[model samples]
Target chain A: MSALLAIEGLRAGYGETEVLRGLDLVVNAGEIVTVLGSNGVGKSTLNRTLSGVLRARAGAIRFDGAPIERESCAAIVACGLIHVPEGRRVFPNLSVRENLDLGSYARGKPRRAQNRERVFSIFPRLRERASQYAGTLSGGEQQMLAIGRGLMAEPKLLILDEPSLGLSPLLVEELFGLIKRIHADGVSVLLVEQNVVQSLEVADRAYILAEGQFAMSGPAGQIAADPELKRTYLGL
Target chain B: MLSPVILIPVLLNGLMTGAVYALIALGLTLIYGVLHIINFAHGAMLTAAMFACYFAFKTLGIDPYLSLFVLAPVFFALGYVLQRFVIGPASHGEDRNMLLVTLGLAVVIENALLVNFRGDTRTIDVPYAFATINLGFTFLAVPRLVGFVAVFVVAIALWLIMSLTDTGRAIRAVAKEKLGAQLQGIDVPHIYAVTFGLGTACVAIAACLLMPSYYVNPGAGNAFVLVAFTIVVLGGMGSVPGALIGGLTIGVVESLCSLFLGDSLGQVGIFLIFIAVLLVRPQGLFGAKA
Candidate 1:
């Protein structure tokens, strides 16, 4: 299948400090491609670069057949390449429903009402607290709202940055299940995470990033079963 | 001893003054709330609008009330351009720098007006400027009453727009979280410009309304701007309704002080109340705790 997102020689960083150096990555259509990394491995940086929040210093990023390296963040979102950023950056002052409503501000505005219903159905808890401020939600619920908001954009490629972070084990399992279900519905997901075992279980293809480079890449099963990767990286 | 005969007119006059203060302070508070910068040049903007309204009246033979239709959109566009070119760039820099820039703009505008219009006080003498309406108990100046009613109308209209519209929601969202709003595809810069324009529009309305009763001069804005700042702080820095309440309260206090104490000490009375309020409720009446 043709790639839904393709990046080559991707280099991005903060002032005077390089984080992502000469990286190449791809996510094909209708697949959950997991990018696994530990702390300070530049996974979040890659997500920022892809979402156009951080400008790529040197790279070519083709998303759904258009070069998006120079695209503004809003333009990238208009292309249905939605990024549910790290830390559940939900508008704390806004009600849950308002946050979801804003997800379609750039794209899918015409079907905002219908998409809101779809999001509420997927996240029944959001519907329950629809009128409550997003800041009042518990951590797990906030995470759900973030993903629900991403879904509101009708994302063709949803880039989730560390969705499993700070969730309880039960919630983590539930989140993985939710990802799998979302993927099954014909949406491509670029899952950037630290939860190796759970991420590997659901992702069709996986890449382990270390020191700003893809240290390993293959089918999910192969990466999970590789004894060397297990002993060294996964610590299984 | 307070006579009801003497007190009634003082109270009404206080309210009328408060209405004008509230109108001006509303713009200041709104700009401060969203931009996170107290626009010191707000007074200058008001002064500029006063000049614009005056010229429209003098040159085009437009009534001050009718001139609003032209002045409002013109001021709004000017505000957008100012934010896009001047304020937007300085916004990303230090807050102190933004403050200095606005202060400089104020000086520049005030001096420019002085250079052109000179120091003479100019007032638009409409036919009804000195006319009064008998309210049974006491007579109210027709111009003041019109301005008083117009203030409430503008305030209510602004409240509805902020609460009911999609654009308002985007604006509020941007104020709450810029990055989150951007992720949702809100153009932050565009919103900022619109908000700045809205703030300037409020000033335009105030300028038009004031032209009926008040005189316009280069320093006219300076006189009101200080009172507007006090009202904003009293009401809660960013609260629209707060500005109204604050303005009224200050107006009543000023009137009462002028009645009992003296006209010169009226401001002293306002300062005393302001300091007392700050001591008790630093966030102002409506401001949420930071």
Candidate 2:
């Protein structure tokens, strides 16, 4: 399959502290690829770079055969590469419905009403609280809202950064299950997380990030069965 | 016993003055609410708007009210470009950079005007500046009454736009949470410019409305600016409804104080209320309970 997003020697950072140093990552079309890493391992930096919040220094990022190195955050989003950032950045004071409306702001205004219905179907709890302030949502509900918002853009590839962070074990299972369902629907996803076992369980392919670059990457089942992964990440 | 004849004009005057105060306060509160910066230049912008009206009226001979048709959009465009190009980039982050920048702009505008116009206080001398409506109980000054109607109409229109429009939703989203709005693909710089434009447009409208009622001078905006700050603090910063309630409340109270104590003491009296509101409920009367 052709790569939906290809990052080659991606170097980026905030100020002088370089977080992503010569990183090479890929998300192929019609696949779920997880970038597994520990805290501060530059997984979020990678996500932010792709999302255009931080510009890449001395690297190339091609989305669907188009070089997007110079595109703005809004312009990148308009190209259908949606990023659902960590900590559930829902517009807190706005109503749940309004937050969802903002998701389609860049690319999908005409189908906003229709896509909102689609999101409501995927997360019924969001519909019940449509008029309520998004800040009042539980951690899990906010995660759902964040993903639902990503879907509202009708994205070609959805990059989710630490979706399972701060969620309960059961909620994590539910969230991973939702991710699997979304992947099954032919949407490409770059799932970045620390939940190695659970993420590898559902992901089509997995990249193990140590330091600022990929240490290992392969089919999910193979990565799950890797002896070092068991000893290092899973502590089995 | 005071008959209805005596009581009606007092009530009319209070409502009319209250309306003008509310209009000016809306602009001040809007800037305070979304930008999280006290735009000291706001009153200066109001003065600028008055100047725009003067040029439109005196040079072109358009009536002061009719000049709003010309001046409002011009000021709106001016506000948008100014906020976007000059203020937005320099005012990023948690620092008080935006406040200082606007304050500096205000000082510059005030001094520039002082040099150009001298210290003479000028009022728009339109035919209707002297007209009055006989309201049976009290004779309502035509200009003040017009100002009252204009305030409510503009306030309601703005409220509707903010509540209902897509652009308005983007603005509300930004005001509520900047980072979240950014992730949602809201171009925050664009939103900031639009918010400033909307806020400044309100000032433009107020300048036009005030032309027929108050004297126009470089220092004139200082008086309304004081009252506008009081209203924003009292109404809760960033709350539109709070602006209206806070403004009208300040207007009536200030008028009543003027009646009882004298003109200068009225402002001193209102400052006490600001202090009391800050002490008791710093969130302001109608602000969202955070």
C-alpha positional error of residue A18 in candidate 1 after TM-score superposition, expressed in Å = 0.7
Predicted structure 2: clash tally: 1
Candidate 1 on B28-142: residue-level lDDT in tens? 8988877778888999999999999988888888898898878888998988888877877876745456677788888998999999999988888788889999888899998
Point out where model 1 deviates above 4 Å: A230-236, B91-96
What overall lDDT goes with each candidate model? 0.88, 0.86
TM-score between predicted and true chain B, model 1: 0.96
Q: What is the C-alpha RMSD of each candidate to the true structure, in Å?
A: 1.9, 1.9
RMSD, model 2, all Cα superposed? 1.9
Q: TM-score for each prediction?
A: 0.95, 0.96
- Model 2 chain A: which ten-residue window has the lowest total lDDT? A227-236
- Per-residue lDDT tens digits for candidate 2, residues B54-110, read 777778888878887778788889889888988876777542787888888899989
Give every collision pair in model 1.
none
Fnat across every predicted model, in order: 0.62, 0.57
